[model samples]
Target: MDAVLSRLKGLTADELREEIIKANLKCGPITATTRAIFERKLARTLVENAGLTEPDSSGGNSAWLDSSGSVVPPCATSATQDSVTGEDGDFGYGMGLNPPEEEALSGTVCPCNVENSQSETQTPSKTAQGSPTFFYGVCPLWEDVLARNERAHVYTDKKEALQAVKMMKGARFKAFSNREDAEKFAKGIFFSVKFPKLDHPSMMEADTINREKANSFKSPRTQDLTAKLRKAVEKGDEMSFTELVWSNPRYLIGSGDNPTVVQEGCRYNVMHVAAKENQPGIVQILLDTLENPDFMRLMYPDDQESMLQKRIRYIVDLYLNTPDKAGFETPLHFACKFGCPEVVNILCSHPDIDKNCKNKYNQKPSEVICERMKEKGQFQEVKQKINEYLEDRLYIPLLRATDNSSQPVIGAPWSPEPMENLSPRLPRSPKDPVMAVRAFAGPLSPSKADEFRRVWKTPPRERADHFHNILKSDPDRGAERVGRDLAHELGHPWAEYWDFLDSFVDLQSSEGLKVLEEYLSKKDFRDRAHEEAGENETSNRFKTPSPVRLYDCLQKRGIFFSS
Candidate 1:
């Protein structure tokens, strides 16, 4: 049971799900969402199913009484067992057992069969308090033997067993608590080997020795170098810092004796310190020196070239993006907060920089700049530059796709001009042509329409209130036509909802314009529209809106708007 539980723990979530399905266990979606849940549920099911199959005559006793009358098992039984058998000439000698006992441990008879035979001949008292049992055998594949001879080796120490396992040619041996697990694992492989559990006291002593050896590697000289390196960063002396780092690159590895300075509970590394001090040169020097191949070799002299290169990349990334201990703010966050545009620009252009990394407060570096602007009434220029940088990072590909060479078709079905003297005239009410004229003339002036277009181009947060002011002033204006015209101009999909405009206007009057503004200005809604239009499909194919779908959504939200 312990072996099976251990094996299940090693499986990934997807692999565990596969195992559950193969076992024909009933599992729901929620159970399959996490690896820990899947393991627990599956382990419970296995234990329960194991309990159900132990009563058959062919099935041997799942457990036996130990010397203390506690339940143990022969042949290392799991939670359940079907049978146990050993063939003649297939058995090997047990460790520390006499030659006379070898016959009793012969392969021709099953260990459980011997127990059953002994039970029938011996009294209950003798069988209940039997001597301690030991198992010994070699698997059919002799090529997997660790020791040259067929003799089984006993391991009372954990370190020796681990070393033995590591020394095996194919590392084919698996250590389990008992023999039944060995048999179960053997079914999937051509060979199997097992090692006994190590004594607890020896393991603890070995751990202590290893810890002592590791501590011995850190000398007074290394501590002095670390102190000097940090001092150079504090003084903003780039040449001294560079010399210290290049002399022994290990000085840059960790926080060492004098850990990074903490301000307001936030621990700052050398990069953070440099950025906060507005020393762009020091930051640049650190960046260049940290990634140098020669410095990397000096730091990790024992590693292979491939492994050394990978470690160097990881170290460089950690230096760039490691968050402060308290706020989880990266060095880039410090640069923005200190209003150092030069440092910010240097960090932003680096290929490995994580521009979108959020702090514990869920604010990105640009957001930090915005918050600073609000407090100090400064950094407005810095805020604008950061926003521009973010926008370029996010939308450059979209801009490249929509560049002037492959221009989008922009005219919708309706004309942008006034509807007074058109040849194909708009629909009019037969009872009141004057009323129809007023409705078709539209309420917004040309400048107001232009303002609406400009509002859409701004950020989403800025659009809502501006839209509310524009649409609230004249609720019955031909706002729908203006929206369609603006959509055509910008190659957006809002124009596709033209037929539902009356429903939207009714919704605005009933629920207030804020609801309408939120619906149209939602980032998710715009993204969905773009996805539905196919990212590359930039033409203005203004389809009519489905009134039923629009009404259904409104009704679900407990809103009724007259059309």
Candidate 2:
């Protein structure tokens, strides 16, 4: 581990001060203890990842990958692109932190703001209609990890979890050997803010959760089994812990009253159970137990841990490797993406952990750090999963106008400067693309820049000339930003696909829209035009389609055709 980070493990403020003074570092009259911890963490971060011996006045790495999945690399070292971007500044992909992933999913159309206008409330376990929904039934591997943690009852268990997390603190992290083991270990130490049992003991809540959990066919529990596992490991009752868990291997293999089968939550394989708690012996015991016919068919999650154990012959192998072998992600990504930091020390060590990583379209982890911070918008060490990459990863899509109303260009950045000064020709700075589609631009599909114009009227204070000359040059460019805000409104990019599908319906309908036009246009006019003279131009009139056509199309798309 890096020197500073190693010292930062569960440190108090006074210890930090003494360490700073002993090291002979500068910075006068620092007051708060929290600041001391943050300073120390930051210092360790700089020492471990920043490559700069001196502290950065510039808020760490200027450019990084945000949750949006857009790469916001350093844009010329100078600060700020706030002209059109406002207080957030144009870090690159023009969208603000308001909707981080939306900007990234939006791609080039990541600029529009969704935070203020629309009211979106997600009831973590429920659908938008307040109905319930669930995906990935019975994450058996996940439950197993929880069970392991529940078994380990000790403060040191948290310490171990903390230490395990360090391996993932930097760029170029490691992957578990295989899916089963990895899934198990990840689940064991997975971060979660709302413990289902902790927050919702009500029957209604339990019913709702169990309904979802039942999909995995697993048994239910009020609190997670992890606390028990965590305690056992904490105390050194490895022998008792192992015996208690494996006492009836027969039960695991399904000879019990209910029989061992996959469940809805808390799944894990033996290998993962071992790696998550750093117990190679437990893993070996599992392998030994699996020789029975009932356990043989059962598979492990990702196999990295089992493989790691087998090769090195002990759990100690994990500690020996330096930065070269560590696989930490940004703390934000780790916290929110997975939900906890019990094993986070390894991940926060990397430099990019703080980089926004978002482009104009998506949100990076840092924007989250900005949120979890305190009253003045500050932070020391981020703890909550809600604000960052927790089990509660928000999948907010860009807003969809109820009708065919046009939204402003999202990922595209137009200049605040006027047109004549804007260069007479097409703008290459995606921020200022000449959105007008030429005649040859492929027929009005979403990607051809055909739908960039506004379908709605201008807002107050908006100039008509600006709307005409600078804002929009055609109907096609006026109305869409779907491909840009996919993270926000997941249906946007697919909007065109649906449109194309509807067009396919039109093709089959009385309209005969696609066939005649595309067909004759592609025909060798010279070869058959003379013989055909002017038969009907064959493309003159168009036919109208019935709602049934749409119904059929929706059915084909697996949407409820009727009902």
Candidate 3:
């Protein structure tokens, strides 16, 4: 009976799915619409493999029991304690809701399907006086000793075991109120491995922790079978998988409904299992075997799809769109959760899939990808793929301007020097002294300022000689207002550059002095100008001039910096 219970507990979803698929196929071809009905039937056929079988509908013993032959009531067991004073308070064993007809070392009765079988009924035997009897934790005790496991030396009376342990080890130990709790701590002394199975509903409330370890426990046979199937999938043992599936077609639909809490907690289908496991080859085989090529071809009118693409689209629609036990999450969600870019790419390519499908959490699979990227460093590649998919869905590129012109894609604010749009363009020789000075200095070149230095440092006679020589070769041809005339000849954008130059040439003019002072004092002007010029590569060409460089140029012509 223990062996049977172990087997039932060990079944895995993958093994079940394979069995169902094979069982269904054994009958004949079934349409997608009829598949659900067939699958339910398939689940019943494979129940034995899942360790669940119909228990006796008539009450005698529950459908299943261990070899020890102990009968357990359907109601949950509770523990009770009767504390007795000695050197330490020794609590008596708990009593069960029903009186004992027979005693067994270990026993369990599980719910199962109806099957006819009967065991010899045992006559009630009276327990010895002061002997503990098994009882629920909350029930009142009849005698002091409620129950005992000879192997573990556990007594219902907590003080009895506590005194024994204290005397032997010379160390104080906690007193347990029930046989199970007493046995758990004292079992180590007897080198016992078995732990009591007390599945009282109230136990769940006491500690809500879900036992993942309990879920994983399985019988040896089930373990071996599960291993064989998984190994076949891992090794891409197509022959083995095919044979296994053909033999057990019912395993295909076995997992969908009334899912085994152990396997289908995530509500994964066969295909979802394959996708999450990253077994694309196995995935291909499952799709190829499960799908009807003729029906698939009819779904697409153009028939342009290659066999591979056709298979992928079919697989995605068949499996990727289906959510697992977790509501609204598809195979794509599982693939994304695993951070598999290869699987994601394949799923995204399928035309029928909703890349933007939201799960119960109102989150898209791409959003899940973003979250997973933070946990796993390798998922960055997966994140990139998801981002590309999102961009493909959410972003639309603007059309380029069709008109072919020499104009820039994004033109500057104004035309080069068409003050044609502004107030009549101040006369080339304005009446304002500042304007006249700006005009005369025309486009000062920081690089050329050294040439004017010789004139400034020279004697009066030499200065006159240098000035005339300058006039002969200078582009201004020694105009009366050399600065403005030279500036105008240099060009339009240089108006400001030349204006700075005028401050040095016409140093006697109050306006020129003011311009020079302003230029020197406003260091941030150049920074602001550069900022306005912009940092973007497309607009950097419009950057403002460097004030430091311009100041050096002025100082070269004997115009030293001042406040």
Cα lDDT of model 3 by residue, 1-563, tens digit: 23332333344545534645675635434555654444556555444344432221112222333233222233222232111111011112222112222232112232232321122223122211112333112211112133232244444333444444443322223444455764455434332333323455766644554321222222223343355555566566778877765554433323221111113356555556666676666766665655644433333333444753654454546565777666667867767776766566556544456777888998888778745434576666767765554332110011112231211111112221232221124464433222112112211122322222222223257346655565455322132223322333333111222443433334434555676667667744433434544466434323444666566645543345456
lDDT (tens digit, per residue) of candidate 1 on 136-228: 222223355434343343232234334444554333334555545543433323243433223458777666644422221322254464467
lDDT of candidate 2 over 1-563, digit per residue (tens): 12345445445666756656655665455456456555665555444342332110112223322222222333232233323333222223221101122232222112223531121132221111111111111111222344334322111122223333342221011234333443443443433332333334596665654341211224323122344443454343557556544543332333222122222233332222333444434434433444333222222222344442442222112221111112332223323333233322222322222334442336554433333323332233434423322221111112222343444333221222221221224335644423321111111223222233132233224545544543344334332222222212222112222343333222222234444345445544333324545654333211223345544644443334223
Model 2 score (lDDT) = 0.31
Give the alpha-carbon lDDT of every model: 0.49, 0.31, 0.42
- Clashes found in each candidate (C-alpha, N, C closer than 3 A): 1, 117, 53
Q: Per-candidate TM vs. native? A: 0.39, 0.16, 0.25
Task: Point out the worst 10-residue segment of candidate 3 by lDDT.
Answer: 81-90
Which model, 1 or 2, shows the larger TM-score? 1
Highest lDDT against the true fold, candidate:
1
Kindly provide the TM-score of model 1 when superposed on the true structure, using C-alpha atoms.
0.39
- Model 3 root-mean-square deviation: 30.0
Question: Highest TM-score: which candidate?
Answer: 1
Runs of candidate 2 with Cα error greater than 4 angstroms are 1-388, 391-471, 475-498, 502-537, 540-563
Judging by lDDT, tell me the better candidate of 1 and 2: 1
Candidate 1 stretches with Cα past 4 Å from truth are 1-171, 174-227, 255-267, 301-305, 370-378, 391-563
